[model samples]
Target: MKRYTLSSLITRLASFEEALAQKMDAKGYVEAAERARRYASEIREIRDFIIVEMTLEPIETLDPMEFLDDAANPEEVDNLRRRVYTKIAEDVEPVSGELADLLRRLSS
Candidate 1:
């Protein structure tokens, strides 16, 4: 299975919301309304899973240079990456079973 980052999922959800808004503004009322409802449901599920299951704390923005600093350890970075991947894989499954596949297709 492909690995997914929380940031990527958040970005996709933003894009989906934008597209749904545009559709609603366009002439496709019925279809757009249906899609909007579905998107809302999906977003709710993701939010609930993140908040309830993961009990995620507020994310802090880190500078790339901080990770790339001369004193930064490679092993530590690898360990952090593995932990993030494991968390995403475990937490996202209950909310969206097709999330990994959707992310793969989107990237492709």
Candidate 2:
């Protein structure tokens, strides 16, 4: 997996939002789209970098996203993982039942 610095991730999100807003602007929401585009452009202007690439295989033993915050509890941790994955991954799939059970048990 490719890992990125927080600023880099934020910048990527901003860029995506800006692109979407610009597309919507073509669809006629000129004012709202312009504001969104501006907000996203400001965020994208931040200095950012990708941090590293990691192998998190076996999908069971090693923690895949240990780089994320540790202070969050079980549910928050899961939510954070899901949200970040949704934002960053190019392809995603559901976890197997056994893996899901293992994760739930581990979090508890």
Candidate 3:
């Protein structure tokens, strides 16, 4: 069984959110969507990375700029964001148990 560390998950979540913000600032909805999609994809990868890093490989830190690069195009990022959000919302539903709370904050 693989151990899941909360600290690493928190780090990856923060990084993903930060990157999404940068993607929004750098581009329009489309680019933002693309970036969001990639971010979602990478989140899963990061999860896997966390599991592996705990047992096998050492984790490599990301460059500050790495988060904002591919997702900088607004239109692309927006599309990605929508898809990613949909997927993530579904995946996180059971554990979070606070969709309304999240939505309220997100809307604010």
How many clashes in each structure?
A: 0, 0, 27
Give the per-residue lDDT digits (tens) of candidate 3, residues 1-108: 122233453345446656676556555555544544555454544444333333432223333233344555555444444444444334443434243123223323
lDDT of 1 by residue, 1-108 (tens): 333345455554445444444545454455544544555455545544443445223333222222222222324323433444344434555544454333333223
Worst 10 residues of 1 by lDDT: 63-72
Please give me the total number of clashing residue pairs in predicted model 2: 0
Expressed as tens digits, the lDDT of each residue in 1-108 for candidate 2 is 444443444445465445545555666666646755665664444323212233222221222334334323334434544554443332211222322332233233
Relative to the true structure, candidate 3 has a C-alpha RMSD (angstroms) of: 10.5
lDDT of 1 at 82: 42
- Clashing pairs in model 2? none
TM-score against truth, every candidate: 0.33, 0.36, 0.39
Q: Which residues of candidate 3, in runs, are more than 4 Å off?
A: 1-11, 23-70, 99-108
lDDT of 1 at 34: 59
Residue runs of model 2 more than 4 Å from their true location after superposition: 45-108
Each model's lDDT = 0.41, 0.41, 0.43
Pairs of residues at least 3 apart in sequence or in different chains that clash in candidate 1 = none
Regions of candidate 1 where Cα sits further than 4 Å from its true position: 1-4, 50-108
